[model samples]
Target: MEGFLQLLLNGTALGSIYALIALGYTMVYGILRLINFAHGDIVMVGAYAGLFTALAVNGPAHPDLFHFFIVLLAAMAVSALLGLFIERFAYRPLRNFPRLNLLITAVGVSLLLENLGQVVFGATPRVFPDIMPSMNWFQFGQVAITNQQVTVFGTSLFLMVVLEWIVLKTKLGRAMRAVSYSHEIASLVGIPTDKIISFTFAVGSALAAAAGILVCISYPKVDPLMGVMIGLKAFVAAVLGGIGSIRGAVVGGFLMGIAESMVVGYGSSTYRDALAFAILILILLFKPAGLFGKYQPEKV
Candidate 1:
């Protein structure tokens, strides 16, 4: 029972991170119907930004919670700006182009970011500096909880709540919904669709950055190519939860995380990554629209 609880806790923590990343995927897809393949790169950027900020402030020394908070905010800001930059420079001009073109462009941008990151940050993986002092918060039988797990879980949940509120209750949320429903209609209704799209990207990228930092707390490493697999898994999470649905993304992420954790805990860890693809294939075959996704037939 203790072992089961341990796995569950670990799974939930992992799921929280996945959920954060998955939110970015679902948000971008919801608003633009264009899969931003580069979305995962934002996580890489965020992790680096946090690492640099922490090092600059207090090199090698474990930072306090407050210092880590500052680093987190800084990462979010940097990632948000990067998000805006990508949307404006890469995606904005191609708004009216074929979606296939946009998809290709997204792939190009992703590759560009990864290569550029390698050039700038190097191909060697770097150990993320310990931003927060590590300590056990509590232990119950075999289930021990750490401060890092608490922070990751709490922060992720808080962000998810804030995101939900923004998407469901606020004026900006209404605008986003309007645009997502029908860009042409939203534009006709005098909503600034471009601005809305940009805002969506900013928000999503910020979330990705937060996820990056949070994951670093647990995994304690970063690399230029780190986002590639994570981004794929998060994409799978979004699709499984029913792309374009915020709640669905969260649900899918947690499910994926738990499933992965179970596989690692009980079965061969070698097949952990394979599980995501396997789940994706099964979902696509059995329920392409996803568990929570509604099917919409495009008018031809």
Candidate 2:
């Protein structure tokens, strides 16, 4: 029972991170129907930003709440700008081009970011600074919960709720939904479709940045190439939960995290990734629209 509880706690924390990243994926897809492959690298940028913040502040020591929040906000702000830049410069000019062109551009941008990150940040992995103090808050039998875990879970949930509120209750959210449903109609109705799309990218990137920072807190490692695998997993989670569905992304992320954790607990760690892919395939075959996704038919 204790083992089960421990796994559950760990899985929830992992799921929270995945969900954060997946929200970015889903948000971008929802708005533009384009998969920004570079999205993950934006998270990488955020990790580095956080790393820089830590190094500049005190190096290696745990940060107090004020400094930690500053670092988190800095990462998010930088990442958001990066995202806006990608959308404005790379994607906006090619808005009328074929989607294949956009897809290729996304891949190219991803590669460019990776190389740039390597050049600027170095390829060697850096130790993520201890921002939050690691103090155990409580224990259930053999399962010990710490301050870091609470912080990760709490912050993730707060952001998710805020995102949900923005998407559901705000006027901007209505415009976003309108654009997602039909950009032409949305534009006709006076919605600034282009601006809305840019906002989507910025918001998504901020979420990814937040995820990167939180993951660093949990695992305490940062590298230029770190976002690749996790990004793929988050993409898979978005698909699994139903792409374009915010709620679905969150659910899928949690499910993916729990499944991965279970596989690691019971099976070989080497197969953990294989298991995730296998599950994706199975989900695709059985329900391509995902558990919560609805299939839409397009006019020829």
Candidate 3:
């Protein structure tokens, strides 16, 4: 039972990280209708940024929680700016191109970022500081939860809530929704589509950076390729929740997280990812639109 509980805790923590990255994918897809393949690489960038900041700040001395917070903010800011820059340079010009071409370009960008990351950070994995305390937290009957799990769970929930509020209540968010509905219409109505898109990427990337930092806390390492698997999982979560739906993204992330955990807990842990894909297949076979995503017929 303790073993099961341990797996569950780890699974939820992993799921939270997946959901964070997934939110970025879903948000960009929701607003701009672009996949932004490089977004995952941005999360990688955030991990590296935090790792560098941590190492640079306190060296191998293990910074405190306060220091981690500062490093997190710095990573978020850097990733957000890079998100905007990518949108302006890579995506803006290709906005009107064939969707196929745009997807190809997105892949190109993803590869480019990975290569750049390799060049800059090298191909080696760097160990991140264990900034969060490892002390045990409250127990759920027989289940022991650690401070790291609590921090991960709490932080993920807070970010999701803050994001939901921002999307539902803010004026910038209103502009964002308008653009999502119809970019040309939004432009006609005085919404700056470019600015809004850039802002959307900024928000998405910032969330991803936070997720990356959180991931580093648990996983305690960063590498150029770190974002690849996580990115794929996040994309699956985003799709499972409905590609363009924010609430769906959140829902899909946790669901996928739980499903993967269950699969690992009971069956072959190696097949955990296969379980995620299986769920995706089932979702597509029956719903087609995703669990939280609304289906709209294509215009002929």
Candidate 4:
């Protein structure tokens, strides 16, 4: 029972990070119906941003709460700008072209980012700073929870709630939904469709940045190619929940995390990575639309 509880806590914490990244995937797909393959690379960039920020403000040895928040904001800001730049320069021009063109462009952008990252950040892995002070928050029998886990989970939940509010309560959200339903109609109704799309990209990228930082907090390592595999898994989580459904992304993330944790605890660590792909295959074969996704017929 204690072992199960420990796995559950760990899984929830890890799932929150996946949910944060998955939210970005769902949002972009919901609005533009294009999978931004480069989105994952943004996570690597954000982690680097946080690393530099921490180094600039204070050395990694001293963990300060204020410095941590500053680093987080800096990373988010840089990521948001990168996302906006990608959307405006890479995607906007090809918007009217066939979606296949956009898809290929996305793949190209992803490769470019990965190669650029290797060149800029180097292929070597760097140690992420200890931003949050470490301490145990809970202990019961053989189960223990740390401050890092609490912070990761709490921050993720807060961000998710804020995102939900933005989508469901704000005027900006209403415009976003309008654009999602029909871009042409939304433009005709006087909504700034282009700006809305750019904003969506910015927001999504920021969430990815936060996830990147949180992951480093938990794992304490960063590399230029770090985002590749985790990004793919987050993409799976989004698909599992329904590509365009925000709530579905969160649920799918938790489910994937728990499943992975259980497998590792009760089974073999070697199969951990393969498990995600296996679930992806099953989900695709059985229910491609995902748990909360609705099947939409493509217009001829």
Candidate 1 regions with alpha-carbon error over 4 angstroms: 59-62
What are the per-residue Cα lDDT tens digits for candidate 2 across 187-216? 999999999998999999999999999989
- Candidate 4, 154: how far from true, in Å? 0.8
lDDT tens digits by residue: candidate 1, 1-300: 888888888999999999999999999998888999998999999999998988888835756878888889999999999999999999999999989999999999999999999999999999998887788899877789988899999999999999999999999999999999999999999999999999999999999999999989999999999999889899999999999999999999999888989999999999999999999999999998998899988897
Window of ten residues with lowest summed lDDT in model 3: 59-68
Ranked candidates (TM-score, high to low):
4, 1, 2, 3
Q: Rate the local accuracy (lDDT) of all candidates.
A: 0.93, 0.90, 0.85, 0.93
For model 4, residues 137-238, the per-residue Cα lDDT tens digits are 888888999999998898899999999999999999999999989999999999999999999999999999999999999999999999998898899999
Backbone clash count, each prediction separately: 0, 0, 0, 0
- Give per-model TM-scores: 0.98, 0.97, 0.95, 0.98
Error of 4 at 42 (Å): 0.6
TM-score of 4: 0.98
TM-score for predicted model 3 compared with the true structure: 0.95
The deviation in Å at residue 220 for candidate 1 is 0.5
Give the number of colliding residue pairs in candidate 4: 0
Candidates 3 and 4 compared: the better one by lDDT is: 4
lDDT: worst 10-residue window of model 4: 59-68
